[model samples]
Target: MGQIQLQNIRVYAHHGCLKEETSIGSDYRVDLKVDAQLAKAAKSDDLADTVDYVHLNHIVKEEMATPSKLLEHVGQRIIQRIFKELSIVERVEVRVAKINPPIGGDVEAVAVVLSSSLPNFGNQ
Candidate 1:
């Protein structure tokens, strides 16, 4: 198996339980990692044979663009989209972080990680 990681995907979006947060929005960081069979792509040297980072980045941006109450929800949506769009992906891990959040203290960020593996993944 091989891994493709897209890290530090920065974006501004509305995602919070507070009304002000949803209205004003906040800065976010997204990271994604996917596992897939890479032997074919390694030998073929063809884009079609590999997991596309552009597509994964697009998914993270698209999902993060939509407003959600929690980072976990956003993370799950990203994972779901990846698995749906990329059939070859055997597993996925997504991290969604809210930067300089509204919490009433000095905090750099808060994040949630969500991951899943395809059922019967070991059968291969």
Candidate 2:
């Protein structure tokens, strides 16, 4: 087993609860971690044997393009997509952050983190 991480993916998206936030949009950063069996890839050195980072980034970008009302919702969607699309992934962790959120205070960002594990379908 091994871990793969995609960190600090910057995206410009319109996602927030406020109307102004959705109209104006903001920068977002996404961090994702995946736990999977990497022994086959390590031995064979083949791309097919492991999860592709580029594909993961594409998925995140696609999800971010759609507007959502909350960071938690966005993060959950990302986690679900990773599990649904990536068959090799056993567990996934996703962090979604909105840069310079309008909270009426000096706040740099607001973030939501979500983690999920795939069920053992083989055993079932």
1-124, model 2: which lDDT tens digit per residue?
9999999999999999999989999999999999999999999999999999998999999999999999888887787788888899998889999999998999998889888888842231
Candidate 1 residue lDDT tens string, 1-124: 9999998999999999999999999899988899999999999999999999999999999998899999998998888888889999999988899999998999999999888898843342
Residue 123: error of model 2 in Å? Answer: 17
| RMSD of model 1 against the true structure | 3.0
The local lDDT score (0 to 100) that residue 18 gets in candidate 1 is 97
- For model 2, the stretches where C-alpha displacement exceeds 4 angstroms are 120-124
- What would you estimate as the lDDT of candidate 2? 0.90
Q: Estimate each model's TM-score.
A: 0.95, 0.94
Q: Flag regions of model 1 displaced more than 4 Å.
A: 120-124
